[model samples]
Target: MTESQFFTPHDLPARWRRKRAFTFVDTTFSAFLALWQRWHDDENRCDRLHVVALAHLPALDTPPPADDPSPLAAELARAWPMRVPGTQRLEFDAGRVVLTLAIGDDIETLLSRLWLRADAFHLDLTATADPRKLCKTLARFAGDDATVCAFTADKQQLERALQASGFACTPRDAYTDAPVTARFAPRWRVRRHEPPLPCEANAREAIVIGAGLAGCAVSSRLAGRGWRVTLIDRHALPARDASGNPAGVFHPIVWRDDSVAARLTRAGFLYALRRWHALESAHHDLQRTGAGLLQIADTSDDAKALAHAIARFAYPPAYVQPMTRDEASRMAGVDVERGGWFFPLGGAISPAAVCAAQLADASANITPRMNTDVTRIAHDGRVWRAFDASGAEIASAPVLVLASAHDAARLAGLHGEPTRSVRGQLSVLDPCALDALRLPVIGEGYAVPLGQDGVLIGATYDIDDADGEIRADGHRENIERVAGMLPALANTSPGIRAGRVAFRCVTSDRMPMIGQFADENAARLNARELSGAWPLDLPRMPGLYGAFAFGSRGLVWATLAAELIASQIEGEPWPVERELAESVDPARFLLRLLRHGEFCAA
Candidate 1:
């Protein structure tokens, strides 16, 4: 059956239309595309329409034909996702419409992993092996009054499955082949935790601490959703910490197996590219390179293995291609010793420019409070208030986000000191140095062409080292590392000692904390009862969130981190998968402590 026959525009309820955001789930691609087209064409649609499409097959290699008559199809085809496992969120209609493609081989497994309050469901009976299991999973995400419409030949089986899963199935009017419809009017509790709902805010205002990429990105996302943000920073301007670096490389990590970190990085890298494109479309100069970035393998054998893995995974050349030694040399414009995978879209970007552009995008809704250090934060059950070193209240809002890097844990009163400071020293080469370096290359170290600023290279990772000085030896270290990748740099010297030193915040697990903070006090009070509690089971501080500890991947992780935090605040469909989001949850450290019986309650 066609998608139009299973569901149509008339099926959308008035209540969902009035909401700030509504989520729609579809098991088939054609139906998802139809829903996307309907929402895109509707002039009086809700503030945001989130369409989650579950696919058991890989994404199409080619997009829709340019001559396709449907504008929606053409636009969606342009943003078609890569053939990667995990969720890929594509935004259209200037961010009003979001399509989350959940790609995997198992439909039930994919549905179970997703976390969203779906307002509507379009199921494909032929796609699922077991309709009962699929319906049970669907009940977990269904919102109040949620509606479901499906076309099935075995109507009795579908109706029984829907009824058993708590949906009140509507009887067909004497038609055996007609589509079945149902509403989420469950008689008993179907889920342990209630499905997500819009955050109850007294006002649409928030206080964002720090002004780096994390803070700026959060403020911009929240402001875009019509929130008034008071942006506070210790520096006189944004991106003055580690984000103050001249340039940073952006790319996704490809491992032999798709690890959690790899998936999270892929999501961040892709989302950052989309956001950067949007910013550039608005005339924002991100100082981004389009020539792509080259990563060198440790050895020739490892390079061959990675290339084999790339082919085995069938990664698109547009995303990443295995590069031969000669090809790597041609791309870098210099002779290289090793060959590795090349990210066609990966390159260097100015973090400060990105932060500036994000802040500029939300300028109308942001009130910048520069040179104000938030030493403490307090929540009074309703609003969160920030204070300065002088004990003066700096800003207060219904919602507060701590994006202050190393200072975030302290400000939020998190127990365990979940983050540590790492001092990194970067060296900037003269324009004449590394003249043959045409694009960014990373391995032991990284080198990027900064136009008139010359080649940007080197980042000495010194853990637990607080000494923030640009030393001559640090420049030597950077030169030697990059020289290993590009043999031409062997003759280069630390002639000018031109570099900058900044501190980076990182967790022991090397993952950034991105979501809402768990209420440590409350959790400790019931430590025994909560020891086995999941992330969602942990009590969260009202109106308080965090987006910090992004060590070196701030350029890539910051924007997606911001979107995740913003989605948490607005209760919108998450930009990443549920498991991926939990990996970066700020409460992860605290949850670990609780689980291990290591946390001591006060």
Candidate 2:
């Protein structure tokens, strides 16, 4: 049935006057109905609604203390729809609407900060509710005719909060599990899913060149946007090269002093995690079960520095924590010698499974071009050509992305620039004794419990090693490094190492080179100083983009990088920091030099 059918008016006394902002105070079902009615009744505009998530959201059982040590309150305050922390102000839809979050045990601060006559007030007390506090705070903060939706499965608490805040909440169909008993609640079920986007525009077709994590993720997003995508990979399936690692670990690269790398990794990590959750539910098997990452301090001094960093930085609970060695061991299922900081959002995944799931989501259009190698790339003013085995053109698209790692740098047209390729070898151990150890993708070299096969150990970084052969020395080095971290893994009696070697592609600056392509001659000539060029127009290399030089931060950085590249091609707002985008621009460094009369092409 349509949403309009759900609206129900409140039953208030004649003397009690209700404002438009505070009008809908019926039962829980009515509160939802009012929200639905309001959303549907309003004109379809791109106006962002200011939201204030009032009330503490707790973990499973215990209620959050009145003054909790965690930063959840601060995070919620900063991330609230309207608020951007440290700015004391809220900008909605670029300042069309403003918001101020009221956070305090005192009722005055809560009332004063909650200024907006809210279109909807999300009163989530699913954690634990103090009715007296809820009533005192919301009663003063309630705007005229504003609709407030309060939640609590506890009948008494629900009634108490509703009566105090002048809200009348009736139960709606709860299709979700009850908060206390996560098992299915019989009366109502809440099927949590992404709300359907308003159907306004028709979908367009997209072609993504690589089927690695980046390509796979972007393809999934495009599909989510109702766009048909053709994901082409040289490999028959996905993750054939560096992406072929059996257990692809996921973690945000947190740095010291909230550096550029740390900030970028944080945003990218959050985006990736959200996208993973939004993907079709059937793909859960691909995601390995584990807590977030536990990043051990590189050194003791660094550990002290990290404690300070965690305090200063705005870290979400999902990804930041400083724990003692004892605490770290408890968090991770094993013994950690050094005290470590953990990213609660970090975990490992089966790379193959993620790729397969993305392809499956776009099964109708993501055509896999297996064993079909593209010898060279030639941009013919309009479209780029992809050649086959016998020098015959296979497929030509207006947009061509070179995501083939080191292979893309070797293509003749790009004038062999130095794209470093190194051989990385990893060993997978049997899960016999290692199963008991709690390995959570540790720092330096890690020992991860691979499903059934064993724990994955050792990843030797061999730079300038062109041959992607599994070197015994490299394997031994990895083993030694891992042994140093875990200590217990030194004994080879129970843990046998099975090596898998892959080549990593890197660039001079270590950033993944993305964006439009330039002629080899032009790039070489203008390679000294390049910056400040919008929609760069030199040689007409249309529909040519490069997504390579990822180094070893592939899993951590690829997905967001892919989206940024795609957005550049589509002329959409870049999905990353402007400086980062500039840093990765294919011709940014080269173009600046030519503009400054420093042409040095050999």
Candidate 3:
């Protein structure tokens, strides 16, 4: 049977889409022995063979009553090697030969799921006489190593199969039943067994699924708290999504009396500034431009409302000052018919630079697993397993956190997650057009800046659209918006334009979703009625957590969001208020559903 037959298209996972090979073949003890001998001869072989003794063979333990290998295989199948370090050794052939234990339960499944053309095949122990599993395993392992044979008494048959498969093979006979071993280490190894399992009273190793700004920040903070963490990302590099933007603005949008969004944004903004300052040495070309965001008042009503809101907050003019249309034009270096509010301390930061710095400075407690994508999440009674598409458990930890934008929803554990992907476009103008504009990070409909090389102008917000493709029409529309905002500079450069597009993950309420996935939903459901009877509100999957729904407010949430998540993992008081901390809870959708009859009704 083909690998496609093993899994339905819809049931297939993303990790499988990225697997290395997909072929299958049948094997017997004779084939296994012959292939093992070949790998032993080829010292430069890159493909390492792993053999997990399905069950201890008769000699090692007491022999079973039945000679049927199927029953024995079933018993051996019951015991799975959860996660083996990348450097384990198994002694076989009575210590005369040594084999590294590299293969496991899902080896065949995962191998077939890969998308690679060839895998350096070595003799593996996962095959059976059954042609179906054999074919599946062989197909998956049909890489550079596909030509290799396993230790088998039927050397003649093995030679024929190799030739048919276009492999040049030489087989050898074994003198004794020396328990041929194939215990090798994993490619991405971490010390196992030393730390207690989730079974350990206090789990030390935690797993984080996404390596975005939020996930990386959380991992760093948790590592600082002395917890060992594995930060995994589907992308080969960190901060490749919204965090990949060249530059991003940061500021707290304060409303009267400090609304939930305002208060949290304020806290998140300040925390981020402080965090960046602490990490400055590691980050390059970082500067506080001093230019604040100016919210343009479109009408008399908007102007009055801005003034009243500023006064209600009682903030110093430095943080929330009002400027007339004339002052706004001069400060912005552009003409504006309306007045606006300016935030002096507000500014922008190069996002990728910060993320790179954080990853570089990450502690020993944090191990970054790049290019590993997680497609399925399974809770096997004790520990939560993050598996790739091939159904191979890649990483297992007491705690699992999902920080990838909307990708968190892909996990069955987070299938009901409340996050939305939004499309946004930003533009850049030529040097001449930029020279006519100021270098401050301005806001309100459209903002302009003189970046390091040229003037940066933007942006178009489309909440319902999630396409990352750069749209010429969107860029043209944004240019028009900018022209209207500063009519005096309309003809500065008629055809000047260059732009980029990206997607933002948002929630219905506009606030970030940060906190234990379990409790947030419980609280949301009980907030109206079952308040007292809510479960411990802990995460459904003990170590599984998430940080998402950041929307366009990534800068505002990355810092405090990380702090809040790290605090929860450490069992400490949340950096922000309880209400604000739970405001962006991952399980808010679940709570909303319980409170409102329908989930999306909110």
Candidate 4:
């Protein structure tokens, strides 16, 4: 029995009103968004729609006059936030609908990296993106029988290109802003680039090596996705490494031009807040000083500059703002010498409690193997096995993720790529000495007040320092840095012989590695075929991944990175953009070398 499915590109209400889940691509978003607002069914059940809108997104560039009459104009004024040149995902109707806005110059280049397949398409073609080239690009992601509706002034030019590009076209009357309907089914065959296929695993079981914040986070995200995660660690419990800090602060960095570090951290900070709230709703116990952490500037001039950025970027007052000396001193409950920025949403949190909470929430799906040192790893064609010092198998699974800080590259056999360890130590100050302090204040060093646990300070960032033993000089340096910000701290000296020392895993570029581990051997062999390769183009070690080199940003980065990894494993839409994803890709170094022809001579 052969039955043909009828498809048309009408207004959202008339075209896709009943669609439970649909993937759509559009150039300008106004028409589709209008359709979605009227046609979406939220009262019955959770609806699902994936929309990729390619546009300059004029509203983000500059707002319309406040007195504009149109709803779109009003929205452009009221809802506009940060919009740099990249992919932006906005959730609506409780995440039942997601709009992935691609705001850049090249539509083909941006669309090429998306891992989604389109079920329908809408376009507004201009002479710059001629109808012919645009149609060809749209065909790359369209389903076998995808339907398209396009808007353009030159109706003849648009319809001709759609017909040539394998669409059975018929001019429809005012069905949409566009007057043409094109159904995809080509007369001639053409080779088109397909997005990366999701990785297939032999089993649902996986072994995560490490019990630090990163490992615990990875385990929880995977477990929530129905994976049986076996968590192995060399230590007895989670957060006993660098994550063992008595208390840590989490906030986004601010740069004058909103550099990559600033933009990426801003996203990370927001996502982490939502993730933490979810974990809390699941009954995870988290200990913190509410919110509002103050960061003193390194110098008086830098404080003024940062204050200018906060206003220039129009950051929400709930996130961060500038503070005068008296204002900051009032927040800290102590007399601070210099003015700085105050993070209203930032505060000190117990790292151990977070790690424990994640593990407990996922207890049913997570199996913890404590003190099981994983010294050697091997893959037996299908499953990966971890061995101890005695060469006895301790854990086995179809997938493996290395989140063991500096040990990750070593375990994954990626040592020559230049990841190293830096030793840091945090000192616990006496409560009486910090009695006047109210909130966590950070400058060269941070001072976190834990109330009954006394105050936490220090954290000297000594590079290439491997000795884990706490030193007297380290304590002195911590006290000195803190004292520089709060003049009253000059009288106190508590870190002489008391502090905890831990090694931090750092990368050459400072961004954490979060993705599938690329197979260097395969890349070297396929060099000619991959002369111009992107991160997704690199050959990957099947079912193996890493979330390492987080350095001091573990508090802010761990949750988001874990979510990114989980999205990859579960074949879900990514939480971050393509360019940002590439920035943190594990094989970026290898791709850079290939791009530079560094391996061609050998």
Candidate 5:
């Protein structure tokens, strides 16, 4: 059916006006784009419109016709995504309208994987294998009063399917070819779990611990959503911990196959770019490099395999390109290593600048309480309160977020101390030390050109070592590792007396903890009944969230982490897939312990 036939101008606006935020699911790209264009044109639209599109093919590669009259189509053409088999989120109308494109070969499998409360559905029945099965899957995501418009030649079969799936089909009109319409009004329960609802809070107030990248990112996101945030930190200013590094690199991971880490990194990398661009548009100087970054493979054979994989996957040149040794050397201005891939959008940025920009963006709604050490936190049923060394209350709110890196698990009172601290020491070289170097080059070790601030290099990852002093051996190790990639650095003298030491929080699996904390006390009380419970089955602490243990990927993971947490607090659709969110759930460790029957009654 045509777009207009499915959703007329008269009917679309009336439906949009009924809700503050609307979610629409489409199985075809053409329908998705058409609806999105219509939403863009509606001036009196809802506050937010989320459109989830599932496609068996990748995004369009060709740009829209230059002579085309539709500005929305042209805009979408410019923001087209790479040919990757995963979810890619695109924002429009200053982030008020979002399109989550799920690209994969199997539409049925893709639909089964998604987890969202869909308000409306635009289904192309011709694309699915079984209409009844599809209807059943759709019922799982349908919210109260959900509506569906389906295009199908077999109206009787479609009506039957919808009726069986708990949707009350409307009587057919005189036109036989018209689409079928239905409303979700089941006589019996159609789902095992209830649909997600908005979070119940007394007020739009929150207390976020730690003022680094994670904390500041959360604060900015919540504030942007009209939440008044209380940001507390032990240090006098933001980004004074792991995020205090002179500069850090940001890029997506590419393995032979699309692994979980690779997909998560890709999402975070893309989201970070958009957020950073927004910051720069607002005149915030992130001290970010425009030039691309080069990666040196450990072996030529490894580089060849990766290049083949890149070709097989058909990655766009704008995202990544395989580079020969000579090509890499030219890109880096000075590189002596094996062939590897180059990330055009990847480069180093000052972590401090990023944190400051985020905090500045939300200055109006953020209250920073600096130089205050939160000894512990306690929740009195409705509100969570922070206390200092002398047991004085530092801050309290109905919503609390722990973004204190290594201290997050400890503060949350999780068993087994699932996170560890890694001491990283970095060395800053003189300006003329590496004149041959131009852009950032990373592999075994990274070398970033900081312009007048000199070249930044070296980060020795010593696990569980808390020595805060900068040692001479750490500098030597940094120089040696970087010299392996940049040959010119090998001849430089060991006069690098300038360096800094900082600790990083990391988990054993390397994935960060990001989401609401599980109710350990409740779970322990019912341990026997919850042994085989899934991540979602575990009861969560009311209004308590976590966004820490990012390890070395803070620059890439922080922004996305914050978005996920804010979405959870507001009970909005998650920014990433449900499986991806579960991978980083703060209670994943606890869930594991429960599965292994490791808990004893208190």
Candidate 6:
């Protein structure tokens, strides 16, 4: 069920021809996992699979039944680690098998919020509410030539319900679990959503600007996909911006309601862990801190609220759990002041090292064209050519990626988009402060134990500040904030006067701007025609993309944003839902204007 067996060349329905198939399952998921394991073992099959399970309410507290080494229920129990509310994606077989389990939430609730096309559906009658209702839910997402396999004792009645919901019934005598199945041939035509049309040619050459975290990530993904990359940068080396920080912490932002930002951050954080692990196995020097991070909720109320959220979501102790002040003290080796939730996976890494590793890994397919400041980008009907200050062509390719932080929009001729520059200064203190500071803790600010570099602190978010020179005031603010939180770091201040300064590019919503840059002038001229347009409907500049506006979350946002761009370019099933993808869409501003009836008038 998790594999692409249902939608292959011979078995594929007409509507989903030549595309990766999305299969929906409504059941206990033990059967689905068995099918997934089978699909993973096959060597000849390569069809991509996206399996979404609108699970029937599970026995949330029930432990796995006593069994031997290999049982269907036991296998599922081991695989389905996060059984909390909302969506939890479990990837196996190296991303070939994606099982999205929507725990505690029903299929209809998820359908209302998500955008997906299900070409195949398997409904276990014992698991679903009503056969008719389940059929209706399938009709909403099923493609024109859909197929539904229903396992039920009352085959005749189930067939009638499916037929009423627009599927033509077929009852077979010799069937395994599902005695009856239905192939869709609706009498009434349904309005189906068409995906964004891929460009005429699947271009394999790309020119990426900026060699920072975002740029290196994009370049590496493209190179892995066999795309020849020309990595360009104005600076002599990469990671010279905010990514130049000695060490920055990585953790998902948690919210009571699990806001879009929080959800995306969780996805990003998980993907980054997978990516970092692979990088380290390949011998990349990440210099990561795997001892976990403690997000100190210094105030009693803050701690209580955080604890409530940790239990509310049923987040596993392995992922995140609340700890007492005493427990935290022991974990940090020497800490006293705050109790908070600890993310066992959250840790810090040198950004420059990660960037260098990505470039080195992609060295075979990536060509460096450094010290080339791209002043302007021009698309001559086919290829996008970048020009230097003296009007010399730096590099040109069919695809152009702008990952140059604040300069991303300017280089792509999208200066109208809002991107604020904030000056940040990080103070590096001597090893004297290292006595009690064990891990990174965020309160008024962050306190990072930078090992040999000593304790790194201070980052004043000075908005609209373009000056990149380090300041004593920034260092003073950093030291005061950390001392206020840890107290033990108070004496480490005099040595913290030395630090580094970098400007960060952040968006109003605090989400990174990703995806294709919309042709705003074209959108303005044809505003009336696109008045109620969605993101995919917006006219975009072909071959021009962005992965900037990461703000202070480059570590968390890097791999996911890179994967999103790669998926879009390859026309693969998106790693994110449509709503999540739209939340970070570069065309969001243009769509906002059109929605408010301002684009046409402007």
Which lDDT tens digits does candidate 5 get at residues 447-519?
A: 8887777788878999999899999899989999988887888877746637999999999899999999999
- lDDT string for model 1 (1-602, tens) is 56566355227545456667888888776566666666666666688888888886554556666787887887887777877677788888878888888888887788888888888888778655568988888898898888898867677888899999999988677556667889999898877887776667989999999999999999999998899999999898899999998889999999888889999999999989989999999999999989998999989998999999898877878889999999999988888989998998999988999999999987999999998888889888788889887899998998999999998999888887889999899888875547778889999999888776778888899999989778888888888998898888788563543789999999999999999888888899988888888999999888889999999888889999999988888887788889999999999988888899885556
Evaluate all candidate structures by whole-model CA lDDT and list the values in order. 0.86, 0.55, 0.56, 0.75, 0.85, 0.74
What are the TM-scores, per candidate, against the unseen true structure? 0.96, 0.65, 0.61, 0.82, 0.95, 0.85
Off by over 4 Å in 4: 1-115, 120-193, 415-417, 494-498, 528-532, 600-602
Better of 1 and 6 by TM-score: 1
Mark the 10 consecutive residues where model 2 has the least summed lDDT: 180-189
Report RMSD (Å) for each prediction in the order shown: 1.9, 14.8, 24.5, 5.8, 2.2, 4.2
TM-score of candidate 4 on Cα atoms, chains taken together:
0.82
- Cα RMSD for candidate 4? 5.8
**lDDT score, candidate 2, position 62:** 34
Candidate 2 clash figure, as a count: 32
Candidate closer to the true structure by lDDT (higher is better), 1 or 4: 1
Give the CA lDDT, 0 to 100, for residue 502 in model 4: 87
Cα lDDT tens digits, model 3, 1-602, are 22332222112222123332122122221222333344345544322232322211222233222453543233323322212111122323322222222222344443332222222233434343332343333443343333333544444554444444334444334555322212112233222111111122147778887777888788877775566888889888888877877677777775545677876776677567656755774454454456677666666567667788777645566557877778887887767757777877677777777776666666678888899988888767677788888988888877777787787866734545466777888877665543656645354445556455565656677877857788878767766666665665466544445678878888778877686666444444445453322222433445666787788778768867876676566443235544565567666566545545442211
Clashes of each: 0, 32, 58, 0, 0, 0
Clashing pairs in 5: none
Tens digits of lDDT, candidate 6, 361-433? 8899999988879899999889999999999988889889999998987877663567889899888887665
**Best candidate, TM-score-wise?**
1
**Which prediction has more favorable lDDT, 2 or 3?**
3
Which residue runs does candidate 6 get wrong by more than 4 Å?
1-44, 47-104, 111-119, 125-146, 152-180, 183-189, 196-199
Candidate 2 lDDT over 1-602, as tens digits, reads: 23322222212212122321122222121133233224334554223332333221111113324464435334323333211111122222222222222222333233333322233344445544455565444443344333444445564665554554455444544575322111111222222221112212123555566677766766665554445666667887787877889886777765666555665565566656644554435555565646566777767777778777776664545557788878877776766657768876677777777777766765765566766677766666555567766889766656666777777666635543757877888887665545666656476787777656778876877788877677767767776776665655666544455778888888776777776676647555444433333324445255566777777777767666766665555433344445555667766555655566566545
Clashes of 6: 0
Off by over 4 Å in 2: 1-207, 222-230, 280-284, 431-433, 491-497, 519-540, 592-602
